[model samples]
Target: MTLDGHCAAEFAGVQAAFEAEFAAGNEVGASLCVMVGDDVVVDLWGGVADEATRRPWVRDTVATTYSVTKTMTALAILVLADRGRLDVDQPVARYWPEFGRAGKDEVTIAQVLDHTSGVSGWQQPMTVDDLYRQPDAAAALADQVPWWTPGDGSGYHALTFGTILAEVIARVTGTTLGAFLESEIAGPLGADYRVGMRGGLDRIAPMVPPPPAHVDLASLPADVEPRRTLGNPVFSAAITADPTFLAAELGAVNGQGNARSVARLQSIVTGRGRAGGRAFLSAETVDRIVETRTDGVDRVLGVPVRFGLGWALSSPAMPGVPDGDVCWWTGLGGAVVSCDLGRGITVAYVMNAMAPGLIGAPRPNRYLAAVYESL
Candidate 1:
C-alpha cells in the first residue's frame, strides 16, 4: 500500500493511521485531507480507483460522497441566510408557496436545515430516475404530509433534505443548487467538488458496496419512521456508478468530490465563513451552525444525534470528534467531513471501498482520533 501525498512533519501520526487502514485491507481507493486555518496539513491519496482498469487513485480522483452532500447543500442555504436572501426562521412556504400544502404551511427553513421538517422521505413510490426529475420529486414532497409532527424531533431526511431545499434555493436564488454552489462557493475556493457531475466520468471512482446490513423492511411496520424514510426509495450503493445518477442534481446524496476537495470547500465554515481571501458567509452565519436545533434520538437513524443548522454538532453518537464549536456529517459508505471552529481545523476522508453502516464508521473515527491526538 504505497500511499502517495504529503503530510506535514508534525502530523506523521495521521499519515501512519491512513497507511495502516490501507495495509489492513480496509481501503481500496481513498483520500484524506486535513487543513489548519489556511494551510493544508495533510493531503494524501492511494490505491486502485477502478478495480476493472486498476486505475490509480490520484490527486484529482473524485467519487460520489453520499450524505456528505448534505453539508454542501446546507452551506448554500446558510449563504442565502447570510445574504438576507432567505431567513432561517421564516416559513419555507414564503418562497415556495406550493410547499405550504399538506399541513406543512408552518414548516420553517431552520427546521428543513436541521432535518426536523418531518418530510424525511417521499411518501409516494419513487425510482432513481424520479430523483433526476426534480420538478416531479419536489412536487411529490410538496404534496405529501410530513411523517411526523414538525420540529418534534428529527427523522433524518436522508434523501429529501436536498430535494426539498433545492427547490427553495432555486426559488430564492434564481439558479440551481449546483450552479449556485459552483458560482459562489466551490469555484471561488478552487475546490473540485460538484453537486452533480457534468463531464468528469473518467475521474470518478465508483463506490463499492459493503456487506449488506440486514434490515427486514417488510417485517417493520409501514408507518415506522426508519422503514418509511429509508425504504421509500431504498438506494443501492452501486447506483453511484451509474452516469445518470452522477449527472442528476440530488443535493442530499449525489455530491461528487474527494477528501481534499471536501476539506477545501468546508474550510469556509472552519475559517469563520471566509476562505480563499473572500467572505462567502458572515461570521454571524458561521455562528448559526452551532446553534442546536434538534438534540435527541433521531426517529429515522435510530441514534441520538445533535443536529445544528446544516451539520451535526459534537455528540456522544459521534465518539471521536472533538467537542466545542464542531459540526460534521458522513456519507452512506464511509466519507466523513468535519469543521472545528474553535480550533480552526477541517478534516475530510473519502473512499471508494465503503465500510458497513452510515455514521460513526470505524475508519473515519480512527483517522479522527489520530488527528485530535496529534493536536
Candidate 2:
C-alpha cells in the first residue's frame, strides 16, 4: 500500500498517516493534499480505484465527491459578488424573481449561502433523475412553501443549495452555474474540478459505500428533521456514478475532482482571493467568508454548526480544526476541505470509499491532526 506523489520532508508525518489509512483498508482510493501559503507541502494518493478491475488510483483519477461540490458552487457565487454583479445582502428575488414566492421574498443571497434560507429540501419528493433537469428542479423547489421561516436558523440545504444558487447565477449571468464556475473560477486558476462531468470521463473512480450500506431511515421518527431533509431525495453512492447524474449540473453534490484540484481552488479563499498568479476575488469579498451569518444547531444535520457565507465556521461540533478565522465543509461520504485564513493553510481529502456519515469522520480527522501537528 505504497503512497504516490510527493510530501515535503517536514510534512512526512502527514504522508505516513495517509498511507496508514489505505493500509488499514479505510481508504479504497483517496487523495490528500495540504497547501501552505503558495507552496504545496503534501500531495499523496494510492489504493485501487475499482476493486473489481484492480485499477490503481492515478494522477488524473477523480471521484464524484458529494457535498464538497457545495464549496465550488458557493465560490462561484462569491466570485459574482466580488465583481459587484451580485450582493449577498440583496434579496435573491431581485435577481431571480421566481424565487421570491411563498414568504421567501425577504431571503437574501447571504442567507441562502449560509443555509438559513429555510428552503432546505423540496417538500415534493424528488428523484435524482428529476433534479437532472435544471428548469424542473428549480420549479419544484420554487412552488413549495418553506418548511420553516426563512433565516430563522441553519437547515443544511443538502441538495437544494446548488439548485437555488443555480437559478440566481443563471438569472444574473445568463449562464448555468457549472459554465459560470468553469469560466470564472476553475478556468482562471486552471484547476481540474468540475461541477458536472465534461472531461476525463474515463478517470473517474466508482464510489464504494461503506459496508452495511442501507441506513436505518425507517427507525427515525417520521417528523425528524434529518429524515425530512435527507429522505425526500434519498440516494446512495451508486447513484452518483450514474452517467445521467454525472452529465447533469447537480452542483450541490455532483462535483468531480481530486485532492490536488480541491486544495488549489479553495486556496483562493485562504489565499486572499488570489491563486495561480490570478486574482479571482477581492480581499473584501474573501473577508465575507467569515461573517457568521448563522450559528446554532443545524436543523437537517442535527448538530451544532456555524455558517459564514458558504463555509462552515469553526465550532465545537467540528473537532480537529484549528481555532481561528477558519471555515470548512465536507462531502457526503468522507471528503473534506478546510480553509484556515488565519493560518494561511488549506487542507483537502477526497476519497471514493463512502463513509457512513457526513461531517467529521475519523479517517480525515486523523490526517487533519497530523497536518496541524507538523505545522
Candidate 3:
C-alpha cells in the first residue's frame, strides 16, 4: 500500500511493517506520524476503521490514543507551572484542599505527577458511568486516601492519573482537564487531540484487540512491574470494555487522539518547551522533568521503570530513540509517544488494534529506529 504523501522509498520498511499487520488482519486500522523539529516527515495510515461496517481509515480518522494522552496531560500541568499558576513542589492539598483528607495533606503535586502518591487505583468499584461523570468522579478521587506513603515509590496510577492531575488543574485554573486542554493546549498548538472527546464519534476508529497470547502474564518475567499492574484480573475485563471506563479522563490512560496530535503536542518537550511560536513551558521545567525521581523497580509496574514529573524517563523497561534525554509513554494497547530532547524529535504512533500489553509493542520501536536513522 502506498503511504499517501509520505516518501515511500525513505519510509518503505516502516510502511511495509504496517501493511503486513493490516494484511494479516492483526490490526484493523492505524496511523503513524514522526515530527523532526517542526517538520512532519512521515504521516501514513491505512485499513478499516470498523471491520463490520467496512469503513476505511482516513487521514482525519482519530482514535483513543490511550495512555499516550498522559504526555499531553503532563504537558498541561507543566504549562500551568510555567505560568506561575501552579507549583510542583507544593502539596496537592494546597490547591485541592479536600485532597488533604485521608492523610494526604503532605502529598506534593510532583509526587502525584510521578505516580508516587500511592493512590494508584480507585478503592471503590467503578463503573463506566463513573468515568464519564467528571464532577462526582473527580471528587471521589480527591476524597480517597493514599494506598501507601506518598512519594515512597512508583505505583503506575493506571486510570486515575488524569483525575488526580485534572483536579489540580481545576483547582488552579477553575476548569475541567478536558476543557482546559482544548482551550489551551490543543487549540493553541493547532493539534487534533482531546482528553474528554466532544462530538465526532463517527470519525473515531474503535480499538482492535491484540492476540490472546499477548494478554497472559506468564509469558513475561514474574518480577516485571508491567506484569503486576497490568496483569490483574480487574484490568483484563476492563480492557475489553467496562461501562465506567471511557466516561472520565484517566490521564494515565484513556487519552484519545491520533498520531499527528500526539507528536504535535509532545513536541513541546522535544523542542525544549516551545512549539508553534508558543512557550508552553520553560527550559528549567523541562530539565526538572527529565531529572530522575525513582529509578528502581516500580512497585506497581514491577519493572525497573523510571519516573520524572508526569512523564516516564527512558529506561530498559521503556526505550525510545538513541538519545538518552528522551521521555516517552505508552497506552494500554500499542499506542506509543516519545519526546527526544537530545535529537529535537518527537514520534507518535496510534492504532485501533489494542495490543494486550501495558507498554508499547515491537511495532513502534521499528518505526522510531527508522526515524533516528533518517536524522
Maximum-lDDT candidate = 1
lDDT of 1 by residue, 145-250 (tens): 9878999989899888999889999999888999999998999899999998979799999888898776677689998888888887877777877888998899
Taking all chains together, each candidate's TM-score versus the true structure is 0.98, 0.97, 0.89
How does each model score on lDDT? Answer: 0.91, 0.86, 0.76
For residues 1-81, write the lDDT of model 2, one tens digit per residue: 788899999998899889888778888999999999768889898888877688999988888878999999999998888
| Residue 24 miss distance in model 2 (angstroms) | 1.3
What clash pairs does model 2 have? none
Please list the residue runs of candidate 3 whose C-alpha ends up more than 4 Å from where it truly belongs after superposition.
Answer: 8-13, 23-25, 213-248
Ranking by lDDT: 1, 2, 3
Q: Model 2 clash tally?
A: 0
The true-versus-predicted C-alpha distance at residue 240 of model 3, in Å, is 9.3
**Model 1 superposed RMSD (Cα):** 0.9
Q: Among all windows of ten consecutive residues in candidate 2, which has the lowest summed lDDT?
A: 210-219
